[model samples]
Target: MIEMSWPQVSARRLERAGLGAGRPATGTGLATVEGPAEGPVEGPVEGPVEDIVAAMCGAHAQVMSAAEASIGLRADGVTRAHVRAALWGEGRSLVKTHGPRGTVHLLPARDLPMWVSAMSSLPGAHTAAPKSIRMTAEQTDQVVAAIREVLAPAAMTIDELSEAVIAATGPWAGDLVMPAFQGWWPRWRMVMHVAAHRGAFVFGPVRGRKVTYTAAPELAPVTDGLGALVRRYLAAYGPATPDQFAQWAGGPVKWAAQAFSAEELEEVVFEGKRAWVLAGDTEVPADPPRGVRLLPYFDAYVVAGRPRELLYPGAAAARALNGGQAGNFPVLLVDGVVGGVWHQRRSGSKIDITVEPLGDLTAAQLRELDEQVDRVGEVMEGRPRLTIGPVTVGGHA
Candidate 1:
């Protein structure tokens, strides 16, 4: 394998490779979308739902609205309705499930086999759980079986599912309490994702304000395992270190090290530290990415990119990050780097956007930012109005 140093891997080149900047390039095992203008947005962009999900490894869906915008920006003529249809339509192609970092994400349904196999291969955590709340392996299995049984015929809300789990496993399963941001939640709620990870259940349609669950159809296991997952990650966001991969996948560093040890990888330096990339991915684009983009909260680029200091840098970091976490604020990306943070509020048919730049923006940059705001409006299907200045994170003012 060839090895190189940090200076050789420019941020501009890395951004081009990772973000699919400029015209979309194929042959990375990702599907690409092609079409014409639909709404106010221009050009034929690459979208095709499966391709977008594959390119990002998975789109974060903890904030559903943000997730929609993430896909809308990448896809040609994709709207919130289209995304909803993809998720809930009769011929569903995407699944909302617990993914990397124990966070919810939208993954291609057909890729579940690889996901299931790779996620299941991680070594079990060595730490012991509290007996009061911890379910034994057999007990966990029983709970999963109970969930599958309850949802096999029809989908049910968490409350109904909790009751069913208690009925199937006895009241003890619901008796344990775990503290959460919303308040104390039943211990049984904790294992819901565990069931999801094991392919027992998946998020179903919302019933009014309540989220429901349903049985997941069986999928054939993928022959390739952790190694394949690592390759996919590298393909999407590479020149990355093992620890970064571990953090993104919510697995142990040792597991990442073992998985990445396979020989196809080419070693390279990133800011004096070591990283690796797929052998074929080493070439950098000659031209740099231009234009501004309004990336929604938890956008894949913001969430998955590493070397935080380099990506965020100085004041941009302070405004965009909340307690060292990246998703608290919607960010403004100027040439693939965080230039500022922004927030938006809607009233009737008009949306007001407020921008907080880390420093002064040139006249041209401001004009580009305005165009980006218009794009945001198109994605939201609303009339967008701009208010350039400091804006709070979390909520719009």
Candidate 2:
């Protein structure tokens, strides 16, 4: 196996994630959308919003605004409006659904077939609900089928769909067994993510103030779909172990091990540990990545990258991460490693950003950080007011 330093890994990941100093290269396997820069806005917009989301695997949409910021940070002139258009406009280029780890994400509609194929089979999270509340595999299948049938003709709100499902599958599927915040939910809710992963339904256009579910659009499933996703994972965040991939995918380590062995990948000694990268992707950057980046909550890089010790090195481990898990707080990246934690509050057209650095930054990095702040503000659609001080806000759910 070849050897690689943490610096090489970070630099390679930065480039793959389109966060490096250089412009994204064409024909690099990522869905390349040629950026036709429109106005005096400086540089190329981050290709089309769909391409940006696809390249990053998917943008976390647990917090939709943060998800928008995550995508906006990558492009030069693109705004949150562009991201929204891709997700909700007539074109509907992006689909908001449960993605890797069963978390809400904005995935490219074009890639839904592949995503559904891979995620549908993963070992899902163990539910905290009591056994009586849980659906058996067969019963889960029943609920999924009910969802499919109810959603086929038209989109429906959760209430309407729940009634349809209960009527179709009997009261057992609708028993109030699962405990939520203050009320018990119907047992069928246990399989919502499962239903989504299997492409039974997807989030539809909002109806007034309520969210709706629509039957997933049909597409030919990709052959060896898991293999394709594995490659995409490594391409965006390579030189990682199967364990990391499993964590990111919210699957089993054994499953990831099986998937990796099936791939034609090359193993490397990454930071004295065995890790794998895509075949023939061993070339590293001559110089490490420079400059600073402010990544929003649940940014793909902070959540998907492996070996937490490296990405959140030293003091960052304590500041940026929430109980060893990344993405709870927005990360301040200095040279591709977590340098601090930041919080942003937008009031009308102005954004108040507070950054608490773990260590003193060099003058050059500070300058870069200033420009980065403006860029983030542009993406967030606010004028930024930078305050280098303590970030007292708690982590996001």
Candidate 3:
């Protein structure tokens, strides 16, 4: 392996790149309320939602509502309607699919070829089946083939699809059950991701309260390799370690090293540890923009960045993370670092926001926070109600 340490880069410059400070780049999700605010931060970037998704690699969509807000904050004149239209409307340009870390994400349809190729190549990608629900290699192949055969002509709900899998593959596939957040899900559902990773399935529009699955639209072949995806990741959230890359990509460290080696990466010190950035990207902005944002649960910005201590320091870290996991509560970003944690609840037409700062806040910072609160309401199409107080972080308030 090649290694050479370059001059140290300031955290501020690294944050500027990670936060998408000047031009359109990265941000967060969610809503909250306490008091009415004057107005919103004017003129958010205006562009196609797909462009924003592509820029961040992908927006975490485990919570569909939060994902919508994440995209709205980045795109100009975007509303819940625009997000829905882009997702399922005629000429749709995006798809909700399983992404890195096996989490749901809103990825640009145009880039599905690249995502499919890179994600499917990850080590242990096909070995998620636990012993209790274990399938022989040949049986796993049968399951994947059955999924393609059943969903090729029409969309199906999980229950309906599970039935089809059992019909095609026999009783063993349907007999398996696995514990999941929503309850005990059929073990067959676990391997369903295999079909998605192979570009054979994607989330279709909601049929009432249940999510449906459909055949993925055919995408033009992409010649880019896994290294290309790694390059984009470094561009948006770089100056990071290979292990961090593996964690973010939900893959093996060996794969990460291979991808990093393929790029002309330059070494730099991030808080005393060796990290890397793309060659020629070492020039830091003299004055990176200073601002605040409310990032939602599982927002891409919170998930992909490394060296969590720097990003969420001191008490802020305690408030924003639990058991080493982030996104339990929406976070408050003051000048690109996590300064506080927040939560929001809506009643009728009014939305209530509660914010808990890690330390003292200036009057000016509080006012700017109100403005951000208003922006959250605007994105959710609801009235803002702001309340400042102590907030308990891990899980819903």
Best model number under TM-score: 2
- How well does each candidate superpose onto the true structure, as a TM-score? 0.87, 0.92, 0.86
- Note the clash tally of each candidate: 1, 0, 14
Full candidate order by lDDT, most accurate first: 2, 1, 3
> What is residue 98's positional error in candidate 1, in angstroms?
0.7
Q: In what order do the candidates fall by TM-score, top score first?
A: 2, 1, 3
Clashing pairs for predicted structure model 2, backbone only: none
Off by over 4 Å in 2: 23-47
Q: Which residue runs of candidate 3 sit more than 4 Å off their true CA positions?
A: 1-47, 125-132, 181-183, 392-397
**Candidate 1: 10-residue stretch with minimal lDDT:** 33-42
User: Can you write out model 3's per-residue Cα lDDT over 284-313, one digit (the tens) per residue?
Assistant: 545544666777777777777566776787
RMSD (Cα, Å) of model 3: 7.4
Point out where model 1 deviates above 4 Å.
1-47, 125-131, 395-397
Please name the candidate that would achieve the greatest lDDT relative to the true structure: 2
Candidate 1, overall lDDT?
Answer: 0.71
Model 1, span 81-121: residue lDDT tens: 77788889876778888888767898877667767777766
Model 2 scores a TM of 0.92
User: How far in Å is the alpha carbon of 178 misplaced in model 3?
Assistant: 1.6
